[model samples]
Target: MPAKPRILFCHCNYARVVPDEVKSSVLEGLCKSGQAFDAVADLCEMAARRDPALKRLAAGESPVKIAACYPRAVKWLFGGCQAPLNAEHTEVVNMRELNAEDATNTVLNKTLTPNLPADGSVAKVEGEKKI
Candidate 1:
């Protein structure tokens, strides 16, 4: 059997980007399911601090599922910290867009779907501008 993708949960503690109920629900589900997972208070803070955990998480060959705000944002955040995730082996469940149940279900699901957008997902291009 293929190895199960590692689960990474972002609490988004500093910013209120992710709804309180959604984060709470997803966390509850994860705890109830008894599946081992890594939870961080905030991804943005981790990136700002250049946390080594990000590198550790991105170092392995196994796929990873990250429950966070936006796929694009998460992608860039990881890249900014020099721990860029594999675009083909990472999945970000957008808690901002997905309800608690949907986010929780997707994270728990065994199917691995690489949802991280391609390069420039964060407007890194020379001409790209944030509107």
Candidate 2:
């Protein structure tokens, strides 16, 4: 059976929305380069759909796992993905803040950082948060 896909988030360090033009350019670059991986500009929005943990949060229920302790800000973006993810394999970069509104002008010659494991395994991205 084909293994489940790993997921990762490339977050901007800055706390702002990356321009739509920048996002499109990045995706185009990835497709042109023949790289493999899913990219989400608004991690929170993506998390809200795919992450079971974040789904629970959306439902207003508290998560039981240690992941319940991470700050909402850190998790608000990634907590929604389904778990059993390869811990050593997954990572989230702070990119929003770095890219900011000027993302179009700022060149990321290297487009779309890898967000998942190559082996197609799912992995957790963050720790728990305490209420």
Candidate 3:
């Protein structure tokens, strides 16, 4: 069986783009679920400084679910730091588009449906992997 995907939460503190209610509720749900997660104050700031953490986060071949604004933006941010995500193993939950509960559920779910855009422009929400 595939290992449970790790959760990565972004506070979006730099631009305040993610909705306040959604961010709080998601964080609450993550805490309540008791799942291990990495919560960063802001991904944009990390990308700007090329923080080593980004490289670490993108290191493992295991799947990762990132609770952030947009898939494309998340892809861009990581790529900028020379820590490009594994598009096939990365699932980006757009807190900007999804409600708090939905976002939380998506992140906490064991099933990983990779959401990174294939073309690098559009955001792909639906599961792209086919059996």
Candidate 4:
């Protein structure tokens, strides 16, 4: 079986949009699932400075799900990485608006499920109501 995709969470250290407690709660839930993930202080800054972690992420062939701010910002942040980031292989969840539980559920559903479409976009699961 193929490995599950990586889940990256940005705490938005600089912007301070999502509450720390909320971010921590979501991170705890995700960690408990035994999935591969990284909860970083600031992915935007890391990507801006060409952090090695970004390079590593770019090199991998696995799909990536990012729990962060706006999708546009996430895309712009990682745009200049050495290894090109393919839009089809990436998904970004807007953490700014969601509560801890909803954010956690979103990440879990997006990363753990095997039913994603060819474009790597998440399809709504049957009977699953959006928070």
Alpha-carbon deviation at 58 in model 3, angstroms? 1.0
lDDT of 4 by residue, 1-131 (tens): 65566788887889768777668877888879887777788887886666768767655678777788777666656654443456666777777878878877888875543222233332233364432
lDDT of 1 at 40: 92
Query: In model 3, what is the error at residue 33, expressed in angstroms?
Result: 1.0
| lDDT, each prediction | 0.86, 0.36, 0.86, 0.69
The better candidate by lDDT, 2 or 4, is 4
**Alpha carbon deviation, residue 41, candidate 4 (Å):** 1.7
lDDT of 3 by residue, 35-124 (tens): 899999999888777688998988898999999988988998887666789999999999999998898888888999998887553234
Model 3 residue 18 CA deviation (Å) reads 1.0
TM per candidate: 0.88, 0.36, 0.88, 0.71
Residue pairs with backbone overlap in model 1: none
lDDT, candidate 2, 75-108, per-residue tens: 3343335433323332333334434323322222
TM-score, cand. 4: 0.71
